[model samples]
Target: MSKLSIKPLADRVVVEPAAAEEKTAFGIIIPDTAKEKPQKGIIVAVGNGKKDEPLTVQVGDTVLYGKYSGTEIAIEGKDYLIMRESDIFAVL
Candidate 1:
């Protein structure tokens, strides 16, 4: 698959989550109904360093996002996310 190569501006980031069919710590196969939306994602694209504020992160950073963070986008057949920097809860 092709990857996107655009950087967002101040207070924005792009993210992709791990797949949903992943196994549990105890080797349990989580049913779809038993799974919650994953809040963990890796930053694929980052903003232009947040407009004069020192950039807290960069591309390839893993982050914890809000439950309802970001708008979804599909670029070149791959999925991505766009959201405010504030929407990111923490860097992991």
Candidate 2:
């Protein structure tokens, strides 16, 4: 699928979440209810920083965020998150 065309606004960022783990190291399959929420993702779009506060992240940067930070969105059947730059904890 093609990338999302939407652009974020000030202090906001768009992220494509990592896939949920499907199996354990021991070869046990994880049911959907047992899967953990992904906390890391690739930045797809970033807003121009807030006045006097330039954003530290850029597109394509992989980052870690809060468990329930961003709003979930679906673009062209692909899921993504949109959150404030402050919501991102670190770049990986």
Best by TM-score: 2
lDDT tens string, model 1, 1-92?
A: 22467768776878886455467433534344654543777788877755478568667887777667789998777778899887887776
State in Å the error of residue 84, model 1. Answer: 1.0
Model 2 lDDT vs. the true structure? Answer: 0.81
Off by over 4 Å in 2: 1-3, 22-38
Q: Highest lDDT: which candidate?
A: 2
lDDT by residue (tens digit), candidate 2, 1-92: 25568989899999998766565333434245654533777899888989999899988887878778999998888889999999988887
Which residue pairs show collisions in model 2? none
Model 2 TM-score on a 0 to 1 scale: 0.77
* Model 1, total clashes: 1
| Model 1 accuracy (lDDT, Cα) | 0.71
In terms of lDDT, the poorest run of 10 residues in model 2 is 23-32
Alpha-carbon error at 30 in model 1, in Å?
Answer: 12
